[model samples]
Target: MSAAETTTAKVPPTRPSTAQGAGGGTGGAGKPAVRRRAGGGAALPWTLLAPCLLVLLLVLGYPLARLVALSFQKFGQPQLWGFQEPESVGFANFTKILGDGEFWAVVVRTIVFAGGAVILTMVLGMLTALLLQRVSGWVKTLINIALVASWGMPIIVATAIFKWLFDTDYGVLNWLLSRLPGVDMVGHNWFASGPQGLAVIMLLVVWGAVPFVVITLSAGLTQVPKELEEAARLDGAGSWGVFRYVTLPVLKPIIVMLTTLSVIWDMGVFPQVFVMRNGHPEAEFQLLTTYSYDKAFVVNDYGGGSAIALVTVVLLLGVVAVYMRQMLKIGEVE
Candidate 1:
């Protein structure tokens, strides 16, 4: 061997190529391109979600925009049926609805009715769900079947049936109550009094609503860890204490979701109340939804009606926002 060659270490000419392959097959300049690709891949899920957002914008956004514009414009019989253009009245419609004492009364009435329904539905649903969890076999099946049947019954149809049940002269309820000792419900005319009729309507709403709450609560209960519940019980907690402390914290999100939906549904309750107030459409029996319909369709005051609707939307948004905040706070705490 030549002395100069033998004195030097051997070097592979292709070592740089192998080094590049080992380091992710990307040279320094190619890294930015790779990173760009990774960024695109990360955004694929959101890209897929775009269609849902677009559909919502088209459906909800378009209607909401029209409603806001309509609230600012007085579109009465002339604009609606006479081919006349609507005139912009700015806040006048809002002021009119807001300044009316009767409108305020209706708003309060709707709020109270919805609140009552939500509370009753939640309490009853929770109790029913707890009971169902303990029951088994045919008893559970019968209970589930009954609740499902109630849920499947259409509100409009149920309202009609209830009207007959509470009828003044020949109602089965009146007859049954009259037969009871010291009870004088016969010929009582349940709908004759405004409060009495409203109370009945609230009960009907709760009856229709509870099944959904029951199903939701039951599903949440299934997700609760049995071991944790047993541990809580072994630690000397009673049923209520364990439920309040252990099960509830875990089910908080579901409870919030169910309550929000119930509140929103009850707030916009119409068919049940409308059917109850069918024959006698008195001002005292008006809910916010019914009152808006009355003003727009019956009285031909579209702008005033739209203003009331906007107010209702605002209240609904406020309630949903509160629930969203609670959910976020709970998530953070967890």
Candidate 2:
């Protein structure tokens, strides 16, 4: 070989490119580094979130864990405060509650109460929404203010007010009913009777529930195309026909979502029922919430209470699952 050719072979023919430096960088070199940095960056949020998660665990998880644990053992305040040890009887609490006719009766009552409350809430809400659409802007503002006030009323205060309003002897409702034609309920002991007592509780639930449903469905109603309703009317569709055909179809998903929320809320209503139970602690009006509460607090049966609460939770989960399945089938939620 010639000297020049030998020198050229000994030295490299091409220099290494800057892109492929000591790092042996491929085209995706930046991407991998970026990915690593992005991953590290992503962990920052979770790191910041760690404290919140810990607090959540302390607040919710601990209580839930305790409740589940208690359900397997016979406990009261003594066991709760570690004053005495509890007797562990696995599944006994569950069997006891499940086998009880009273518990089953309460379950049925709770279901009925939830259904009635949900229906009344949706109906009144829908009607209120429709009414809002017909009113002027000033009327809307006033109506919305009233709704906000109603919604913002504390449960305790609302329960108190309801108790006052239906206080058999001095109640405004009884007074009003007394004045009405063919009615004689002036001094009627409203809560003395089971049917009347249940009605009062239902009224309270429905009253507190309606405002939220009204506001949410009002928003949904606004999203509905006005043109569709107008077209339906042009085709000789009355108000009912327009609502049933055009408006309802468009608002079905929203309605279902709200109904699901209402079911969840009304099913777990505690304060109102608790207060009402003070007046009449019958199987007729005793919902799961008040029933569980009475077991836990009133009777001091922690295991039984826990079992009842757990059963109520399971029922709620079942209902939510059914609702979500329907919503998912229709692609309402991702």
Index of the highest-TM-score prediction: 1
Model 2 error, position 303 (Å): 0.8
- Number of residue pairs clashing in candidate 2, backbone atoms closer than 3 angstroms, sequence gap of 3 or more or interchain: 0
What TM-score does prediction 1 earn? 0.89
Tens digits of per-residue lDDT, candidate 1, 222-289, equal: 99999999999999999898999999998889989999999999999988877788734688789999
- How high is the lDDT of residue 196 in model 1? 88
Model 1: how far is 114 from its true place, Å?
A: 0.6
The candidate that wins on lDDT is 1
Off by over 4 Å in 2: 1-54, 81-83, 234-236, 277-283, 332-334
Question: 1-334 in candidate 2: lDDT tens per residue?
Answer: 9999988889866888866673574654666787899999999999999999999999999888888998999999898799999989999999999999999988887788789889998999999999999999999999999999999999889988988888878898889888999999878787777667777888888888888889988888888888998999999999899999988987888888888888989889877876666644666668888888789988999899999998888888888898888888778543
**Model-by-model lDDT, in order?**
0.89, 0.86
Model 2 residue 132 lDDT? 96
Q: What is the C-alpha RMSD of each candidate to the true structure, in Å?
A: 4.0, 6.8
Cα displacement (Å) at residue 53, model 1: 3.1
